[model samples]
Target: MVPLSFANQEFTLTTSGALYWPGERALLVADLHLEKSSFYAKHGQMLPPYDSRETLERIALAIRETGARRVFTLGDNFHDSEGSARLEPHAAGMLSALTRATDWVWITGNHDPHMEARAGGEIAEELEIAGMVLRHEAKAGETRPEFSGHFHPRLQISVRKRRIRRPCAVVSTSETSGGRMILPAFGALTGGMDAADPAILAAMQPAERIDAMLPAAGKLVQFPLWRREQNLV
Candidate 1:
């Protein structure tokens, strides 16, 4: 099986919005939005109630596949404060089971500020373990091997005149100390924006390097993260 890029130092990142640090044998995920479908359903969208089940199932499968004994949620692991509350009992049970199997840390996200307190995991605005900064948002005027989420980075690739945008992990090649990485959304229902577009660009250096996980190519592809010529939205 083709594996995603894992940081050589302490934390290894996967294109699936997950990470693996060999030192801790931990699996990291970002923007899970576990009950996203339910959140939409509550607003009368009435999407299938299978979002939670599907998300948990995928995470579980990743754990089993990687043999990871720990799990860390970068942020936005929950759709909203009440999203988990809306979960079907079985869905909640499934999540609990996943947490029970490993050391789970639920970092705070913009949407789920109460995740740590409500969910069965430790809460932290950001964590520094083994020389890496794990946070929800990218810090301003600070650079220390930051690993974060919230950008929901996506890559736009044109395949035969058709432009296809796919959610992806963005790792910076600037820092000497393992650099930075932005995870894609792992939830089944959370919406995302293409990182290749100007509207998606923030303080990003524009000339930075990008590595996109191409499962179809069985390898991470390197690209020049050039400035977006136009904005979409």
Candidate 2:
């Protein structure tokens, strides 16, 4: 994990893509998309069928590594509304154990907008914590510091003449709107949108600077994605 400061608060970004909030002793992850493979298999696309288990295990590992007493999932906790029902017995057991061990909050997302809290955790459309809004998606007009997930931003960079892509969080900061960070998808099966995509930039507009960040080799590797060009009044 490496220190990442945003909105005047300090956080740690784990290599596995989980964000650790030291002040709150919490772990924030986004877009679990559990059971995504099963959702695809239902449509004649047979995936490995172990996506849910893998995702659950990673979450557990993150909690253990961070020693987080609370967990906040940004959204799409499951691939679909009925995904929880399809959780394999082992994966279901693992999830139950994790929830019982910590304070878990599931924020609803487009994919699981109507998800219920029957899965052993609290449910919310959004959450306010330590002066920051935590939600599933970033609202362009929101003026407060916000932490969200939905874009699953990835940064593609060339290394040694070869191109590589890594999941990253896009951080946007502006004097008027404070700061907004969009976390990468934590699920194994989730796809990514380029961090520099116009849609992603627009979502985090009114920015002085925008950066894509990820943890690498015990350090936070930050790439400047965009900056406001100087304008004369």
State residue 181's C-alpha deviation in candidate 1, in Å: 0.4
Identify the runs in model 1 with alpha carbons over 4 angstroms from their true place.
Answer: 1-15, 116-119, 175-177, 198-201, 205-214, 227-233
Give the runs in model 2 whose Cα sits over 4 Å from its true position.
Answer: 230-233
Clashing pairs in 2: none
Candidate achieving the largest TM-score:
2
Give the per-residue lDDT of model 1 (tens digit) for 1-233. Answer: 24544346644445465666767788878888877777777788877889889889889988987789988888888888777677788888888888778888888899988754444767788899777788887664345677777878777878899998887766655443455677778877777767655433443433244444434355555555552333323
Question: All models: lDDT?
Answer: 0.70, 0.92
Alpha-carbon deviation at 72 in model 1, angstroms: 0.6
lDDT of 1 at 206: 35
Candidate 2 per-residue lDDT, tens place, 1-233, comes to 89999888889999989999999999999999999999999999988999989998999999988899999999999989899988889988989999999999999999999877656999999999988999999888788999899999999989999999999999998989769999999999999999999899889877888899999889999999998874224
Cα deviation at 117, candidate 1, in Å, is 4.6
Q: How far is candidate 1 from the true structure (C-alpha RMSD, Å)?
A: 3.9
Q: Give the distance in Å from residue 182's predicted Cα in candidate 2 to where it truly belongs.
A: 0.5
Question: How well does model 2 score by local distance difference test?
Answer: 0.92
